[model samples]
Target: MTVIHNLGFPRIGKQRELKRAVEAYWAGELPQGALLQTGKELRSRHWALQKAAGLDLIPVGDFAWYDQILEWTCLLGAVPARFEHAATADVDLDTLFRMARGRAPQGKPAAACEMTKWFDTNYHYIVPEIQPNQSFRLARTALLEQIAEAVEAGYNVKPVIPGPLTWLWLAKGEAYTQGATDAAKLDLLPALLPVYQDVLARIQALGIEWVQIDEPILAVDLPAVWRDAFKGVYSSLQQGSLKVLLATYFDGLRDNVSVLNGLPVEGVHIDAVRAPEQIAAVRAQLSAEQVLSVGIINGRNIWRTDLDKVAQLLKPLKAELGDKLWIAPSCSLLHVPVDVEGEEGLDAELFSWLSFATQKLDELQWLRALVDNKVDATVEAALEAQRKALKTRAESPRTHNPTVAEKVGKLTTLQRDRAPFSERIAAQQARLNLPAFPTTTIGSFPQTQDIRKLRRDWRSGALSDTAYEKEIRAEIERVIRFQEDIDLDVLVHGEAERNDMVEYFGELLGGFAFTQNGWVQSYGSRCVKPPIIFGDVLRVMPMTVAWSQYAQSLTTRPVKGMLTGPVTMLQWSFVRDDQSRADTCRQLALALRDEVHDLEAAGVKIIQIDEPAIREGLPLRKADWDAYLQWAVDCFRISTSNIENDTQIHTHMCYSEFNDIIEAIAAMDADVITIETSRSNMELLEAFENFHYPNDIGPGVYDIHSPNIPDQAWMVELMRKAAKRLPAERLWVNPDCGLKTRGWPETTEALKTMVAAAKELRQA
Candidate 1:
């Protein structure tokens, strides 16, 4: 019989109990003990669910207070010099909170670790800081405690964690990160391996049989040194009595499969759903005695599995390998919502075609029974349900719109090409003469509690449409006055009427679905409910024109028409898998193109099409980058071009490295581009040092993600660094990203200081 197990599960409660508890703890209302108790309760509940699902080995150490990578940071005792942790009986929860949030209970703030997307997923993890000669000790005992907690509950558990090579590979020191010499970090592997050995020793003492050591980096194009280091790292693990299951996901091992040819590991898990072609190559490397776990379920999106197709594929493998074959998800279920059974009022047909974390578990169980040729009544029902859902989705007429398809087909280079940058900039300057280092914001402003309540009341029908519009207009007026008072050169309506950048548009557009509660964690306690794009995307009327018109009517200052770009709307949402992603994105681009035309007609001077996920949507392998980048750039251009030369199109990208895709970015041809660089202190300017980017650039003056405010001098200094790379006239002063999650006071002060810094730059 084939074994069924999960790599991990979503830690946040279905209703976001962990986010509420942790946020309350940060606000000083809930005590640390109470917050910890909530975690324990959630863990117990989750572990019990996994056991009831009939998993062969329940996953432990998958629960995290903040992030799994940061959890490992504490476990390795790799605390940076700025942070000071205390000793606790269990774990230093306070210190862990401080490192993630940058505040230590009433004390001075330490700079939080740099955060970035986790390997093409929307989830964010705190990047580990590894300095030169960084030594390690067992700093955290939470993993061990969780293991014991699961064992005491009478469940056989497999402890999952990042391997030493991946941890060091992801760190940000001299040799720790990519594009650097791996020799330095590889040399420290000798010191790090003993820590792993010690950790495995404690886990082995718990009577656990296998440790799922994840090495997702092997899926990427890795340096040769890092590839060589994995062998020695796992080879040393042979000293322990426990068996190790080396897991890699998101992509195949590619050439990295050769390194594991004769490794000492007992099992290897491959993401067959993503890279099934490499299964034969990987199976060739494994010995007959070793177990091979095939991740056959789709873990990234919320789509139901095709049971018959999967059974056909796995049955042959099951016959070849027999009981040695294992079935699991392509990756952890952390990227998806917890359960779809609880979701109500969504489209009934779409619901049938959906599968959340809990539902995926059911699919995995049925897969096992199907492969074993033991179709009991329960498994048969599941198989039938899966078959019905797959059939309905395949033949649904709602998935296609002839008009939208015609529009997308008609789009060409003429629709994408704009006026030359030199001519367009001169026209823009002639229409609206501004300062050398002008000040502006990315798009949104602070979305305060009152603003959230107003939206809630409107949605619940407690507030009439007239009243809602009145209140939103009042808020826009206040925002306009605030920007004017702060002397920001360009202004936005603060997006007070919007709920989310993507969801607001989805609500007004065709071929989209919304859920009552479909939350996925974006970063630390912050969660995003992504829209479901199930059909052709077409906005019937304008999405942002009304709001932009109202805001512009309130002030003479240039008010931006804020819109989430085609790529971001497609990348961030649970996009339909029926068509090619490139086609769906092109459809979205054609739809948004109509909005750009309307916004320009409404007298909105500058329109921002936010494509922060462009880099996030890049293919994992370099060989596939050009094809993806071509469509991505074309989609952005189709959405942004064909405007008046003086309309001044702008785009914003945040928290992603641009050195690799700089040319594709330039090809988008926006009049101005703003990017997040404050977290790295203008370090991202290196992208511009080589590439002669023609258009204007704004390398964000301050990071808007953090609550810590930088003064005018700090903003001036950052702008000065940017000024060195490009001419003063080409530099715009703006915050790193939107201020949706921030409080009003901080947003006000930050903008005031930013405007003052722009003045200083102008004077210089």
Candidate 2:
């Protein structure tokens, strides 16, 4: 019989129990014990779900309350000096967050671990700090406990751990890591290997069959030295009693396939979801003794698998490997949401077309059964539902708008900008009548649980539509008051109306399909179920104007209407593979163009359309960068073209590494651009310096992601550095992104210091 395995399960519970528990623990409403209890309950629930779905190998050690990478850091004891002391005791969740976000609990000045987006995904992870002279010791006790927990719960679990190569690959630079390269950090691994060996020995003693070692770095371009290191590391690891299944996901292992051929590891898992062409090559290349786990299910998407197509794709591989071929998700099920069955508010037709985590497992299980000739009529029925969903999506009126397509095709480069920056600035100043050295937040305030619950309740019909609108409006009013109190120059409605920057737009636009539970992990425990763009996208209604106008009604400060830009919305969504991304992006731009004009007509003086993901979505290879950037830049221009020159188009980017595409960033031609720079100490602005960005700019003065209150003096020093690099009149003072991740007290204190710092700069 073919084995069914999961690389990892989603840690956040079906109802987002982990998020609620974590927030409650932080709020002091729940204790640490309660948080741990919630984790246990979630883990048990996940195990039960996977078992009921008939998985042969349910994974342990992959569940993390925070992040798997951080767990790897803790396991190896490669923590920076700051977190080392904290981990000396049992790793507390609060201490972990403190280390990750940089909160100083004991009066020590907080230095947060650097955070960056995880591989083109919106999720953020804590970058492990490894000094050049760093040493690692095996400290994988936490992982051991998880294994014990699973065994104690009566499940024979496959323990999951990040492979050595991926662990080092995911780490930040030593100057960033406080100074360590893998070569300099090599001594630490010698100490680290024993703990992993011991853990394997312990599992073997407990009669555990297999352990999954994930080395996803194999998909990326690697140095020859690293390949040699992989050979040496696995050779040493082969001493362990438990069999190793080295799993590689996300992309194809092209050149690196031979590196695994001679390795002592028992089995290897490949991601067939992304690179299906590699299966034959991998099968041909692997030694005859090796067992191949084919990842046939689409873990990252909501579209139902055509079982016949998957069965056909796998038949040849199955013919070669027979029962040796294990069927698994392309990567981890953590990327998918738990259940589509619970989504009552979604379009019934669209819902039928989708599969969440539960559905996906069933799909894989049934596919294996089909191959084994054990599938029932239920399998046939499910396949039909998928076919119907695809058909409905393709033929539905929701998928097209002739007017929107025509508008996109007609757009010129001139639409990218109404006028040059110098003229636009003068025009904008005249229209808005705002003070100098403007201060405004990106968009969102904290997404408190009550707000989430209210939205959920309203969606489920537990709360009346009127009640939901009243609650959201009340939140907007509160935010407007707060901004006024801070004396901000430009204001935002706090984005309480939006569940996500991109999802909000997708919900308003035509030709978008939402899945009942199509979730993909952004990073750690946070997941985003992005709405799918199946066809041409267009805006039929004003999405943000009503909220912006309402917020404006409460303030004299010029409120900036916010929207996720065309390129960002396209990049973030699961776009149709058939359409040229440029064509689709242009369609979205045309849709947003209507909204820009609508906001302008509503008397909103400034419109800040955020395109944070634009630079991130760039192709990894430098060879293909320009083509992607050109269309991306043009899309932004087309979207904002309908607005008048004096309307003052502003854009905000968060967690951006804006080095390579400085010219493309310049080409977006927004009058003002706010970028996240606080954590990097204005270092991210080097691209702007090199390119000589002529637009008014805001490089965030303080890291808003952290709850630590930055002193006014700290912001003043950052502004002082920024002033040297940027002309003063062209500089705007703002927090890095939104204050959504922060509590109100911290947000208020940080902004107060930020405002004071700006005031001091003005005096200077």
lDDT of 2 by residue, 36-84 (tens): 8998888889998999999998899867766787877766766567644
* Stretch of 10 with least lDDT, candidate 1: 82-91
Candidate 2 accuracy as lDDT: 0.78
Clashes of each: 0, 9
Give RMSD (Å) of candidate 1 vs. truth.
1.6
Pick the TM-score winner. 1
Candidate 2: regions farther than 4 A off: 83-90, 103-109, 173-203, 376-378, 384-398, 411-414, 429-436, 447-478, 513-529, 553-556, 574-582, 620-624
TM-score of every prediction relative to native: 0.98, 0.91
